[model samples]
Target: MKYKTFQTIILISSIFLSIGGCVTSKPSAENNTNYTISPPVSNNKMVHVNGTKIVDGNGNHIKLKAVLLEGWLMWNGTLWGAGLTSETKITQRLEKMAGKEQTELFRTAIYDHFITEKDIEMIAEIGLNTVRVPFNHTILEDKNPLEDYSARGWKYLDNLMTWCERYNIYVVLDFHSLPGGQGAFVSDPEFINVWHSEEHQQRTVDIWKAIANRYKDRQIVAGYDLINEPDAPTGKNLVDLQKRIISEIRKVDKLHMIILEGGNFSSDFSMYDSPLDGNQVYGFHTYNFFTDETDVKNLEKLSELAKKQNVPLWNGEFGAHKLSWIEDQLELYENPKFPINGWTFWPWKRVSENSNRYRNLAKIIPGDDWKEVAKGISDLFGPSNKITPEFTKKAMDSFIEAVKAENIVYDTEVKDLLKKY
Candidate 1:
């Protein structure tokens, strides 16, 4: 629970590396022949929930082997080497270090290069059928309600959805960051507790409702993941908020599956009494620290809950461990008695400069006094206080190149394990 600074850095890195590494290898000709790559099924159909299984419109079962796209729309300080702790801080510091125009340029460069068409092709090639795209609420909504928030965020998401459609990969849109921070980390920047504030809770519901309405008919979107690893200090409050969000979503889109995560970082489900809807999936998250027996026992509890509610159980997030640890957890997930519907690995990529490949995919900008910045001398996230426009341009170039290059390291063992089931 208490992660040292270095360990936290390593864990964030490993989370991305472990998942991203799985898709890095180029599929051999024989391997490609093993799996038939087909055009996406007609967009007229939607994925729905059956008893303990996710099935397509035709009733064919779908086991969603997925990977999470982290640190793209959402910023994690440790993962990106910014040391600012939140996306808001990261953006603010970027603006301070470089003017608004230059900041936009930097962001565009990183976002454009971070994930490309090739990545989606590789994911589909590996036999995984779904991806969970984690995004910050701010991307689609500005602080000022009157301003148009959908334009900027939609551009990127639209691109991703198009790519997913091309590859027949279902996407689970995850609202990782809420209006007010839901948890205590960079991913959930609103630290004031979203559940306690009526305004924040409404904002959360409104944003989800808007998203549901927009993508309701798009089959490429697997579902609306209501939230990601929400840490509601009060369990009842979390349940109430989720109920409200689900109610609002159903008002518009009843076709797509709705994913509801458990409280306490998605590891506890004691508050849940029944499935919110027939097409709902209960979400849970696990880490690599648990013992194998403990993992099996906990998953069995989830299975029991799924059976009791007559819905499916999804490991919405898990990873950041050795290949052996990942194999053990995957085995537990594949166990028939537990009957887990599916799981999404924590991250798809991180910058791996050391032996421990669990760090951020984006490397730190070199020639900068990042150590002092990490220690909190100043909030600037670039090279230095005396940073010139020329230096900024060069640094941004090198940083972008490093990110694109570092994001492609492969872990053959993890890939092999995932390809099995």
Candidate 2:
């Protein structure tokens, strides 16, 4: 499917949903529809790890230079200028302020505008060959998760894969948040309950099975990232859960590579003495405020681990730091001793009143009312209840408008930096 075709489908779906009621309205059994996914495009070949390197179907070694699509399917509050907060909390707050219908509309607006074909084109133009798509479990499943998947969620993935396929970019499906929260970080703010609940663990595994089944034959899908930056009680527990998920996914998907992140925000890997699976990639993330010394040590450790296990390594998430820090990390990744198979930058875009902290490829300019609105939502200056619904609507609408691809300001310096490697 082409980009214009996707737009037409979205327009028609929106119209149909509007006639029936709100797009996010709870569906009745009689009116329920499952989204039809287009057949996977075979422009790219399936990639697998071949002794510490990722080789494609034709046995060509490939290094995945990628960017993450954050704040799109998973609505992190920080991305929308609302401080560090979870998607669930943000949605609940939006509903409290704007009624369910209006809140759903706001979500629809963000989903439609956040990352379009134009954005994918820009990524390809920047010379990145892959995309890291992070999503919350709710994006694919409804309240009754195991029974059926959401049509809306399927549409989002289908559209993304179609766009990536068109641009020859591989997609890494990252399950950023699971049934219960996987970590205490803002990225997993539903609550850190998944680590303790067996039901949540099973749900998490089942979610991967479903995703793997859906994209089993899709060559453009580079891998199925089991969980993102998990924070388990013990490294053994983490590896056990990961191994189980891998076992289940292998039942449905044998071709796609399985990517695993260690516990403690993917910074620890002491539990594994050897690779658990043949085609697995061990992914690690780096986020430091002041120094690259720690990063240097960690990369060297991961290099030794990769060499010992004879598996590929990926810097699945990094960036959101000073430009100089990004350059330093890039150099570290490309060092022949470390031998990193690939690396994906943390975020492709972000909205910031202050860009002095961490630079992103695209800068989202939240409107004049944003600072107050952001404070209100995050309860910095005051509780969200203190803000009028009218004010909330105005500020949020403007922010949504600002998130459009056409409205974004790309940083050429960042683009040039990415193009260099």
Candidate 3:
């Protein structure tokens, strides 16, 4: 758990030196009895951290310039122009108003079009080498007590990996929403507070274990981001859960990197004394809403910790600011003094809403009718006011069409900015 000297940490560099730079682990019978594990095809590069730098199978350094496929698997209310309501409430309301079957159909359509092979092609065209995919727990596991694992959720990831591999891009599978909930915001739909429930913690471990079991042999996967922005009661609690998750994952898969984010919105790392896993990266998220000066200071402190611990640092999530400010952060990430590995922009697409402060960052326009649907589900809509079922149906259909890569208009400026870096 603790390292006495940095030299001891350097031993991690030898952990992966195989053809794909991975220690291959066979699929476990108990977890993956029917699943077949295939050897990675020829010349597929696996990524691992070498002391302080992230490198590919050939020992070449790799900076993970990525974008978060935000609105794809996880339905963030804000991304839908529905204000800051929790995904739980939004889905429940839609089900109630639109009927369960209809709502399910709408969800299926959204999932199908939100991010397809076309999106992956666009990401590759943008010249970015990586994508950080944030998926809610509901995508993979049953809600609350957590019982059954969904095949649909697994298919989403399976599809993504296939597309990313074809496009020659790596993926960081991010568990954005935990079992019970991480409390507040659109990320946690149930809002039950995952830190308080032992069942939820175990469920979290099981989810990661299943993920590791499923993707153990897939070299296209860059890493597993354990949890996204854990808002635990204390840093120790956060670190404890992360350690457990990492331990469980290593049991099934040890080849891929394990990315750990700090507590309190990934800003606090005082609890982490040393790296828990050999092929690991410390991820942090920042919008730099305060002053620009603090951005440098924050990265300086994180960069120093990475060096002290002898691991790579990553800007996991960012970019809800002006393009110029985001470009500045990208510059800082590349600075020799900081030496942070790379960054994944907060979100790739969202509805352009007037009420949203980060509206400028939205690349695709969801459609004019999206605002009406957003208001229908939002708290501001009173009982007296009603959105007819016909209107809802029409809007939902429009939404499905709008999210398709070919259907929606893209903010070329944002693409141009990302391509520049």
- Residues 341-388, candidate 2: write the lDDT tens digits: 778986888886357667778888887776677766677444556677
lDDT of 3 by residue, 71-155 (tens): 7777777677776555676777676667677777887787789999998898798899999998888878753232243878888
State the displacement of the C-alpha of residue 196, model 2, in Å, after optimal TM-score superposition. Answer: 1.1
Residue-level lDDT of model 1, residues 325-389, one tens digit each, is 67678878887787677888766665343424343212334334333333231354344667555
Model 1 ranges off by over 4 Å = 1-44, 82-84, 143-149, 187-191, 289-294, 353-392, 405-407
Displacement of the residue 148 alpha carbon in candidate 2, Å: 8.8
For model 1, give the 10-residue run with minimal summed lDDT. 28-37
TM-score for predicted model 3 compared with the true structure: 0.85
Query: How accurate locally, in lDDT, is each candidate?
Result: 0.68, 0.75, 0.73
Ten residues in sequence with the least summed lDDT for candidate 2: 28-37
lDDT of 3 at 18: 18
Among these predicted structures, which one has the highest lDDT? Answer: 2
Give the clashing pairs for model 2. none
**Which sections of candidate 2 miss by over 4 Å?**
1-45, 144-149, 186-192, 292-294, 380-386
| Candidate achieving the largest TM-score | 2
